[model samples]
Target: MRRSFAFKCTLLVIGWLLVAIAAVQIPARTFWPAAFVALTLPVALGLNLAAALYWLLRNWRVAALPALVAVLTWPHFQRGLAVHPLHLAGAAPKATAGQRVRVLSANVRIFNVYPQLREKDPASPDKMIRWVASNPADVICLQEFYNEPRPSRHDGRLFQSVDRIGEQTGRQVFLSRTLTNSIGAEFGMAIFSRFPIVRRGTITFDKLTQNHAMFADLRLPSGDTIRVFNFHLQSMSMDEKDIVDSYSSKAGLKAKGLGLLRRFKRGMVARSVQMDTLMRRFEKSPYPLLLCADLNDLPYSYSYDQLADHFQNAWATVGTGVGSTYNGALPFVRIDNQFVGPQWVVDDFRVHYEVPYSDHFPTTAEYRLK
Candidate 1:
């Protein structure tokens, strides 16, 4: 009787694990699916451990259920393991000094505007600016670059202080978009170049939202024109409404029994449309491109795979160590990236986590023309 009871309980846990694993594929816009999957992944492992204990206790055949649960959680297991900075060693061809260009891309998170968040340290802006001053990169691409507005009553200039960065570094600065209109202050994307910017243009994506790519034609000291593309992609949105309505919610269970099917179908359709639009624009660029941005996706994800079809990941070339670029409270994901084309060889790459002005750490790379 004791053995039978233990076996039944183990089987029940295995069923629960299956339900959780399937939630990821379900069509719901809420946070519940991801939350539940995150929670249950570990619980599934614990249940598997319990099954092993039961096997030792009574030699029951039910131990296989927990082992099966572990297998089902393999995707999450891979995600956790693949978060490091991948260095593509031996990928870049040799080049002389003038044939190489060093570029740096950083999403400075509007200079720590969301200070309440875990990653935005108070000293981050100053540290990053100082670092930029010292580094003297040939081409610097900045997302969340800020320009000060008019003086406020309490503070003379809010972000105006950032303008001094380019002046101090002796690099020409160009803004891609403005974040605020007050005092004519704006923050968006900006490029600082030690060499002359021969030409620059912007590409905008139309998806009921404003997402853009900024391109700069850099005339290198060697007189070669290399086009650099910098962009930030559409975020997952993952709004509060989505979180509350997700499959892990109590409401999710109620919906599962009701007309929840329609809601999930709509959500999936919308997500697919957004991804398709983003990919189309990426496919049309007409240069030997060196693209950098906060891609907001992982290496093994569909977004990464699609982008990799046209460009090589620079971090995989020369980056060493845990190259995770997001320095938020969790500190696990590597959403920031650098992707290059066949025209250039990646020489070295680094993720600057010590300077935390933004939610993301800055990623820099050295490249040589092939």
Candidate 2:
């Protein structure tokens, strides 16, 4: 009887987790609590997989339950893991002309503008800035981009990174600066393209932080034009210290925990609203779309689904192995993404884990207009 009772309880827990997993598909706009549940999807999925393995050993019939759900939601599973662990660098075939545009997207943490962030490889000229300028991607979308047109009192340098990258790559640039300082330091989202940009525009959020997006229409050499939207969404702003303290601190555990919870919820709700606005404007885009974003939300969230609903997520479509792009205290999280419209094809996608110059490792994808 005890054995039977234990089995029944396990089944109940499994069913509850399955329901919660499904519940996360609901928009945070409609049900705010779903946001928190979405955050648990990764853990829930891990447990569900474990339970399935347990049942397979003990009771083959019961194992079918989780197995069926896993198969049905296989696409969602692809968000985090691809069975095949492909190479991240120096493996893919080179792009051919007239049919391909290799794109790179990164936050770059303002190219480690502050001196302390350059601890990884400290030098006179920031190596991160130099790397970006020398990058060969046809199109590059950067967030938290910083440009100091002249030598500044703050940093004691001339960080004309924006112009330098544009000149180095021979790419036309469109920067949507959200903040400008007295020292001529400009920070914003930027899109650099080898193709001529015929048009450009910006989308500012409602009473929010400096997070924003910019769209550029580039005319390819093959006489094709595509709109590329580069955006950085609402960040949780959870610093390394905040995350470390939440678990390691002995004093005021309850208060620290609550603060973290509130921050998470606020970020989710903010992203939901931003996503709704983004979709409303970009859905009816005049040309084929290629969206590169630092979504600041997880793949399990409604914000992710909002964009994935219309576009093909490059990671889910072609990425292999771990999909994390963030390289900070929360290393496993993948908030950076590249999405393409129905007519676009993703040939190769990679998160550059080898590069550790910033908070976010760069994501690159080779796309073709189909």
Candidate 3:
């Protein structure tokens, strides 16, 4: 009788966790607490699964609670991690007109403008820029991109990335300078294309924030046009040092924890507004969209699901492992992502873990337009 009572308690607990996990899909606008649910999702899922196994033989009734939640959320779990490592595909098909196109997306963190980020390696910045220029990908979308156009105003003129990369790769560059330094260096998101850019523009989320999205319509060599959106969503602005300080005996946990929670709440609200704007564009797009973004939120977040549920998450379709992209955050967090429209076929996708020049790793994907 005691064993049966314990089993019932376990089922009740698992059911509540499953409900919270499901709440992550609710927009932060509707329910702010939903934003924080992503952080708890992994723990909830693990405990639920463990309980299901623990009760499998002892009580099939208790096991059913977790079993149902597991099956129901299987689609989200599959996209979050590619459990089958060896089963992922290899080798992108050769470039065939507009059918096969390779693209690269990254948040280069101002190319280590603050050398401290790269441990003061001056050459790391130049190396990063050159590596990107040399990549054979047909399209390159970058966030937190910095460039200097004129040599007369600033010493940074020599590092005019847009011109240097364009000259090296022979790709048409379309960029929006969202922020400018007092000395003349410009910072913004950019899209470099091997094909002609027939139209280009920027979507401004606010007058002050550096975060924004840009789109370019590229006319492929085969004459088909596709719209590509490069997005940098509201950053969580989470500093690793603060995360440490929160646990430090020297500091009060209540004070630090509240500070972190405030920022979390702000970011959650801001991202929802931004996503609503992006979704409007997504619905009205005239051509197929290849979305490349530095979401600054984990895959478990609501924004990630909203986009992934609508478009094809390239990684979920053909990637391997946990697909982590953030350098400062936890290991399992994947904030950088690429999603394609229905007409596109993802051939190969990669999280460039070897290139550790910034806080975020780069991602590449090869797609074929049907």
User: Which model scores highest in lDDT?
Assistant: 3
Question: Runs in model 1 with CA error above 4 Å?
Answer: 1-98, 114-121, 149-158, 207-210, 239-286, 320-322
lDDT (C-alpha, whole model) for all candidates:
0.63, 0.80, 0.81
| TM-score of candidate 2 against the unseen true structure | 0.90
Q: lDDT tens digits, residues 250-366, model 3?
A: 455666778888888889888888888899999998898899999877777778878977999988877877899987655577889999999888777888888888888899998
By summed lDDT, the worst window of 10 consecutive residues in model 2 runs over 83-92
In candidate 1, what are the lDDT values of residues 1-370, reduced to their tens digit?
9778877887777776666555544323344344334335446545766776767566645556565556665444433242233334544454564377788888876666445732535665556666765675788887767666456564354345445567666777667874566557676788888878888877666521224578888777766777787777655444334434555678765855244444434434444344455566556656567788776555534445456556777765455443688765444568788888888877777787677666678878888876
Off by over 4 Å in 3: 2-6, 57-65, 89-98, 152-158, 248-252
Per-residue lDDT, model 2, residue 95, is 40
TM value for model 1 = 0.64
TM-score of each model, in listed order: 0.64, 0.90, 0.90
Candidate 2 residue-wise lDDT, 226-246, digit = tens: 999999889886766777777
Off by over 4 Å in 2: 1-10, 85-98, 151-158, 207-209, 249-252
Collision count for each candidate, in order: 15, 0, 0
At residue 243, candidate 3 shows an lDDT of 69
How much is the lDDT of residue 275 in candidate 3?
88
